[model samples]
Target chain A: MAKMHVKMTVNGKAVEALAEPRTLLIHFLREELNLTGPHIGCDTSHCGACTVDLDGKSVKSCTLFVGQANGAEITTIEGIANADGSLHVLQEMFREHHGLQCGFCTPGMIVRARRLLAENPDPTEAEVRFGISGNLCRCTGYQNIVKAILAAAATLNAEKEAAQ
Target chain B: MIPAPFEYHRPASLAEATGLLAELGEDAHVLAGGHSLIPMMKLRLAAPEHLIDLQDIAELKGIARTDGEGGGEIVIGAMTTQHELIASDELARAVPLIREAALQIADPQVRYLGTIGGNVANGDPGNDMPGLMQCLDAAFELDGPNGRRRVAAREFYRSAYVTAREDGEILSRIRIPLPAPGHGFAYEKLKRKIGDYATAAAAVLLTVSGGRCGSASVALTNLADTPVFAADAGAALAGSDLGAAAVDAAVAAALAAIDPAADNRGPVAFKQHVAGVMLRRAIARATERATERAAEQTV
Candidate 1:
C-alpha cells in the first residue's frame, strides 16, 4: 500500500504527515507527531487509554486509521493544559484527588473526563462514574477517579459563573 | 496488532464506491466507522485487500423522514454514528427504542465512531441494533450496480457475520416505519459490564388499547447464530393484557427460539434463563408504557 498524505489540526496546531493506510491514529499521534500523551494500554478498543477528542466527540484512536481522521481537528492530553502552561482544571482535580496511582491510564482518563465535563458540566457521582466508564484505572480503584471528575465539574461550573 | 496492508479508497460518491467494490472484487470491504472491521483486521480475522471507505459519500449521511405522506418512515443514512442516533430527537419521537438500545451499545467513545449501518448490516449477533431493527420491522436500503433495493431487517440476517447484502451492494440507509402513535417500546439487555456484548438482550414494541395489546413484536440479541425474531412470542401478547400467564407464554416462546452457545458470559442453560428474563422485563416495560399512553389519550 502507498503512503497517504494526511493533514489535520492536532492540539490546536496544523500537522501533516505521510502515513500508510493501515497506521492506527494512536501510532500516528505517538510516532509521527510525538504527541505521546495518549497511551495505548490495549491495542483493541476495549481500553480507552487511546481516547482523544475528535471534532467534539471522544473516540478511541487505536481503532481508527489515520486516513479516517483526515481533515478532522483532534485534541489529546497535551492540549488539555491551559494556554499559559498551567494545569487544566481536570488535571488539577486529578492531582488533588489522587485520581491516578501508576499514571498509565491518567492521560486517557483525564482527557475523557474533560469531555465528559464539557458534555455534562454538572454531573452527579453516578453520572460521573458512567461518563468515564470507558476509561479504566486499575490502580485507583475508581473511587478517587470519580471524585476527581465530579470535583472538576463543580469547579468549572463555578468558574463559568464567576466569569459571567 | 497491526492490520495487513491494503489499498484504501475514499470514494466521493455512491457510484464510485460501488464501482470500486465491483472492480476490487470480493477481496474488498466497505469501511464505515470501522469499530468492528478494524479490530477484525488487526486480529487477522479479516484481511481485505482493498478497503473502500464510505465516509466521504454525502448521500450516505444524515437522518431524515421519507417524502411519503401519513407519518412517513424515518430514514437514517447508514453512516450515521451511534452517537447521532442517541442524540436524534426525531428518532426519539419516532422510535425511542433506538435511543434506548444505542445507549446500551458501548461506552461514549465507541458510540461516537460506531455506525448503525455497520452494526446491523454486518449481522453480528452480539450487536444491539439488528435485534431492535427486527422488533421495529425496519428496512435496509441498498445501492449498487443494480440500483436501489430494500430488505426487511428480519430477513436480512442469514447467519453470524453474514447477511443478505451482496458483494457490490452498499447499505445506504435504514428505513423504519413509524410505530403507531403512543406505542410502547423497550430494549432490555443483560451484560457483564459496561461496553460488553450482551449476555442476552431483548427488544419489544407493542400498542395497548383498553388494557389489551393491540399488536406486539419481540426480538432477541446474542442468543443465536443470528438475531432472532420471536414471532410466536410476540403473538402471545397480542389481544391480551400482558398478565402473568401471557407474559410467561411469551417468555417461554422467546427462550425456545434462542440457541445460545456457551462462552465467557455463561453456559447454554444460563443464557436461556437470562434470555427469558430479558424478554419478560422488556415485555413488562413495553406493557407499562403502553398503558400509560392509553391513559394519557383518554385525558
Candidate 2:
C-alpha cells in the first residue's frame, strides 16, 4: 500500500502530510504533527483517551484512519484554552474541583466535556455523567469530574448572562 | 494496534463506489463509519486489500419522508449517523422507536461516527439496530453493480457477520413504514455498561384499541447468531388485554425462539432468563405507552 497525502485543519491551523492509509488519526496527530494532547490509553475504541473533536463532534481517533479524516477540522485538548492563554472554563472548573487524580484521562474527559457542554449548555449531574459516559476515568471515581462539568456549565451560563 | 497496510479510495458518488467495489472484487471492503471494521482491522481479524471509503458520497446522507401505499415512510440515507438519528425531531415524531433505540447504542463519541447503515449491514448479532429495524419492519436498500434492490430487515440476516447484502453491494438507505398513529414502542436492553453490547435486549411495538392489543411486533437481540424476530411472541399478544397471563405467554414464546450460548455475558440459562425479563419489561412499557397514546387520541 502506498502512502496517501492527507490535509486537514487541526487546532485552528491547516496541516498537510503524507501518511500511510492504515495510520490511525491519533497516530497522525501525535506522531506526524507532534500534537500529543490526545492520549491513546486502550488503543481501542472502548477507552475515550484518544477522543478529539472532528468537524464539531467528539470522535475516537484510534478507530479512524487518517485518509478517512481528510479535509476535516479537528480539535484536541491543546486547542481548548482561551485565546489569552488562560484556562477555558471547563479546564478551570476541572482544576478547581480536582477533576483528576492521575491526569491520564483528563484530556479525553475535558475534550468530551467541551463537546457535551456545547451540545447542552445547562446539564444536570446525571446528564453530565451520561454525556461523558464514553470516556472512562479510573482514578477520580468520576465524582469530581461530574462536579467540574456542572460547575463549568454554571460559570459559562453566568458569563453569558452577564454579557447580555 | 495499527491496521495492516491497505489502499484507500474515496469515491464521491454512489455509482463510482459500486464501480470501485466491482473492480476491486472480494479484496475490497466499503468503509462506512469504521467503528466496527476499523477495530477488526487493528486486531488483525480482517485485512482487506482495498478500502473504498463512502464518506465523500453525497447520495448516502440525510433523512426524508416519502409517500407509500399505506402511509408515509421514513427513508434514511445509510450514512446517517446514530447521533443524527437521535437529533432528528422529524424521525422522533414519525417513528420515535428509532430515536429510542439509537440512543442506547455505544456512546456519544461512537454515535457521532457510527452510521445506521453499518449497524444494520454489519450483521453483528450484538448490534441493537438490526433487531429494532426488524421490529419496525424496515427495508434496507442496497446499491450494487447490478443496480439497486431492497431487502426486508427481518429477512436480511443469515448469520453473524453475514447478511443479504451481496459482494459489491453498498447499503444506501433504510426505509421504514410509518407505524399506525397512537402506537406504543419500547427497546429494553440489558447491558453491563453504556458502551457494552446488550446481553439480551428486546424491541416491542404495539397498538392498543379498547384496552386490547390491536397489533404487535417483538424482536430479540444478541441471543443467537442473528437477530430473532419473535413472530410467535407477537402473535400471542394480538387482541389480548395484555394481562399477566398474556404477557407471560408472549415472554415464553419469545424465549422459545432464542438459542443463546454461553459467553462472557453469561451462561445459556442466564441469557435466556434475561431475554425473558427484557421482553416482559418491553411489553409492559409498550402497552403503557400504547394506552397513553390511545387516551390522548380520544381526548
Candidate 3:
C-alpha cells in the first residue's frame, strides 16, 4: 500500500503528513501530530474516547481513516482551552462537579461536550445526557458528568449574557 | 484493529466517481459517511483494494422537493447524513417518518456521520431506514457505467449485505413520494441500548377518514434477513376502523411474514411477540395521528 499525502488543520494549526490510507485518524492525530488528547478506547467506534470535532460534527476519530479526514478541520480536547492556557469552562466544571473518577474518558467526554454546548448552549438535563450519549464514561456512571455538562452550559450562557 | 491498506480516491463529481468504480471494478468500494464501511474495514470483514470517497461529490448532498406524478417527491442526495435528515425541517414536515427513524439510529456522534445512502444501500436488516423507506415506497436512484436507474425500496433488498445494487453502481439518491396530506406516521423501534440495532421495529403510515382507515402501509425492521414490507398487514387495515380486531389481524399478518432467527436479541417466540407489540403500537399511534390530522383539517 502507498502512503497518501494528507493535509488538514488541527487545533488551529496547519498539518501535513504522509500516511497510509489504512492509518486511522486517531493514530494520525496522536502519532504524526503528537496531539494525544483524543484517546482510542474501543477502536471499534463504540466508545466515544476517540471523539473529536471534525467540520462542526462530533465524530469518532478511530473510525475515520487519514484519507477520509484529509483537508478537514478538526478540534481535539487539546484545543478546548482558552488562548492564554486557562482551563475551559467545561474542564473547570468537570473538576468542580467531580465528573471523572479514572479520567480515561475525560478527553473524549470534554471534547464531545464542547461541541454539544456549542450546538446547544442552553441544554437541559436530558438534552445534555442525550447530547453526550455517544461518549461513554464508565468510572463516573455519568451522574456527575451530566451535572458538569449542565453546569458548564449555565456558565457559558452567563458569560454570553454578560458580554451581551 | 487497522484496516487493510487500500488506495483512496476522492472524486469531485459523480461522473468521476462512477468512472473510478467502473475502472476499479469489484476491488473498489464507494465510501459514503463511512460509519458502516469503516468499521467493516477495521474488522477486515470487507477489504476492498480501492476506496472511492464520495464526500467531495457536490451532486450527492442535499434535500430538495421535485414535482412528480402523484403530488411531489422529496429527492434526498445519498450523502445526506442522519443528522441532516433530522435537521431538515422540510423533510420532517413532508416525510416525518424518516426523521423519526433516523433519530432511532446510532447515537449523536454516529448519526453525525452516518449517511442515509449507506444505511439503506448496505442491505443490513438491522438498519431502520430500509423498512421505513419501504413503508414510504421510496425509490433508490443508482448510477453506474451503464446509466442511471431507479429501484423501488420494496423491491431493493434481497438479503443481508445483498441488494438490487449491481457491481460498479452507486446509490445516488432516494426519492420518496410525499405521503398524502395529513397522513399519520409513526416508527416504533425496540432496542436494548441507544446505539444498538433494533430487536424488532415497525413503520406505519396511514390516513383515516370518517373514523375508518383509508390507506395504510406497514413495514417491519430487524425481523428477517431483509426488511419485511408487510403488504398483507397493510391490506388488513385498509377499510377497517383501525379497531382492536383489525389491528390484531394486521399484527398476525405481519408476524406471519417474518422469519426471525434467534439471536442475542431473543428467541423466535419472544421476537415474534415483540414484533406484534411494536406493530400494534405503531398502528395505534398512526391511527391516533390520522384522526387528529383529520380533525385539524375539518377545523
Candidate 4:
C-alpha cells in the first residue's frame, strides 16, 4: 500500500504527516510524531497502555490506523501537563497519593482518568473503579489508584466551588 | 502489533464506499472503528487485500430520528461509536437499554473506538450489542451497486465470525424502532471482570399491557452459532403476568434456544445456568421499567 497523507491537530498543533495505511495511531504518535508518553504494552487491545485522548474521548490508539485519524484532534499524555510542565490535577493526585508503580500504565491511566473526572466531577470509589477499569496497572493492585482518583475529584470540586 | 500491508480507500460518500467495496470484492474490509478488524489483522488471523476505510463518509455517522415523522424510529449510523451511543441523550431517553448495554461494553477506551455497526456487522458472539439489537428488533441498512436494502437484526448474523454481508455491500445505517410507550428493556451479562466479554449474555425488551405481557422479545449471545432470537422464549411471557413465573418461563425458553460451547469462559452447564439467571434479572428489570412507564402515562 502507498503511504497516505494525514492531517490532524495533535497536542493543539496542526500536524500533517505521510504514513503507511497500516500505521497505527500509537505508532504515528510514538514514532512519527515522537510523542512517547503513550506506551505500547499489549498489541492486542487487552492492555490499555496505548490509550490517548481523541476528539474529547479516550480511545485505544493501537486499534486505529493513522489514516483513520485524519482531520481529527488528539491529545497524548505529554499534552496533559501545562506548557511549562505543571502537572494536570490528576497527575498531582497520582503522585501525592502514590497511585502509580513502575508507571507502564500511567499515561493511559491519566488519559482515561481525565475523561472520567470530566464526565463525573465527583465520582464515588465505585465510579472511580469503573472509570479506570479500562486501564490495567500490573505493578499496583489499584487500591491507591482509586484513592488518587477520589482525591483528584475532591480537588477539582473544591476548585470549582472556590471559583464560584 | 503491525497489521499486514493493505491498500486503503477513504471514500467521501456512501456511493464511493460501495464502489470501492464492489471493486475489491471479498478482498475489501470496511474499516468502521477497527476495534475488531485491526486486532485480528494484526494477529494475522484474517488479512484483507484492501481496506475500505468508512470513517470519511459523513452519511454513515451520527444519530437521528427517521420514522416518517420522527415519532417511531431512531436511526444510528453504522459508524456510530460506542462512546457516541453512551453519551447520546436522545438514545438515553428513547432506548436506554442501548445506552445501558453500550455502557458495559469493554470500558471507555474500547467504547470510544468501537462502533455498534462494527459490533453487529462483525457478528462476533462475544460482542455485547448484537443480542441487544436483536432484542430491540433493529434494522440494518445496506448499500451496494444494487441500491439499498434493510436487513432485520434477527436475520443479520450468519455465524460467529460472519454476517449476511454481501460481496460488496456495506452496512449504511442501523434503524431501531421506538419501543411501545409502556415497553421496557434490559441487558444482563456475566463477565469475569469489568472489561471482559460476557460468559453469557441475555437481553430482554418487553411490551406489556393491562398487567400482562402483551408481547416480549428475548435474545442471547455467546451461547450459540449466531445471536439467537428466542421467539418461543419470548412467547413464554405472552399473556403472563410479569412475575417469577414469567421469568422462569423466559429462562426455560432462552436455555432451550442456547447451544453453547464448553470453553474457558465456563462449562456448558454453568453457562446455561448463568444465562438463565441473567435472563431473569434482565426480564424483571424490564418489567419494572415498563410498569413505571405505564404509571407515568396514567399520571
Clashes (backbone N, CA, C under 3 Å), per candidate, total 0, 0, 0, 0
Write the candidate numbers in order of decreasing DockQ. 2, 3, 1, 4
For candidate 2, give the lDDT of residue B299. Answer: 96
Ten-residue stretch with the least lDDT total in model 4 chain B = B65-74
Over all chains combined, what TM-score does candidate 2 have? 0.99
> What's the CA error at residue B239 for candidate 3, in Å?
0.9
lDDT by residue for model 1 (B38-142), tens: 999999999998899898898988889664677678989999999899889988987899999998988989998899999998889999999999999999999
lDDT per residue as tens, model 2, B7-108: 999999999999999999999999999999999999999999999998888889999987777798999999999999999999998898889899899999
Q: Which runs of model 3 end up more than 4 angstroms from their true locations?
A: none
TM-scores of the models, in the given order? 0.98, 0.99, 0.99, 0.95
For candidate 2, the per-residue lDDT at B48 reads: 97
Error of 2 at B252 (Å): 1.3
By lDDT, rank the candidates, best first.
2, 3, 1, 4
The regions of model 1 sitting more than 4 angstroms off are B66-71
Tens digits of per-residue lDDT, candidate 1, A28-115, equal 9999999999999988888799999999989899999999999999999999899899999999999999988999999899889888
| CAPRI-style docking class of model 2 based on DockQ | high
How many residue pairs of model 4 clash at the backbone? 0
CA lDDT of B9 in candidate 2?
96
- Clashes by residue pair, model 4: none
TM-score of chain A of each: 0.98, 0.99, 0.98, 0.97
Docking class of 1: high
Interface C-alpha root-mean-square deviation, candidates in order:
0.8, 0.7, 0.8, 1.2
How far is A42's C-alpha from truth in model 1 (Å)? 1.4
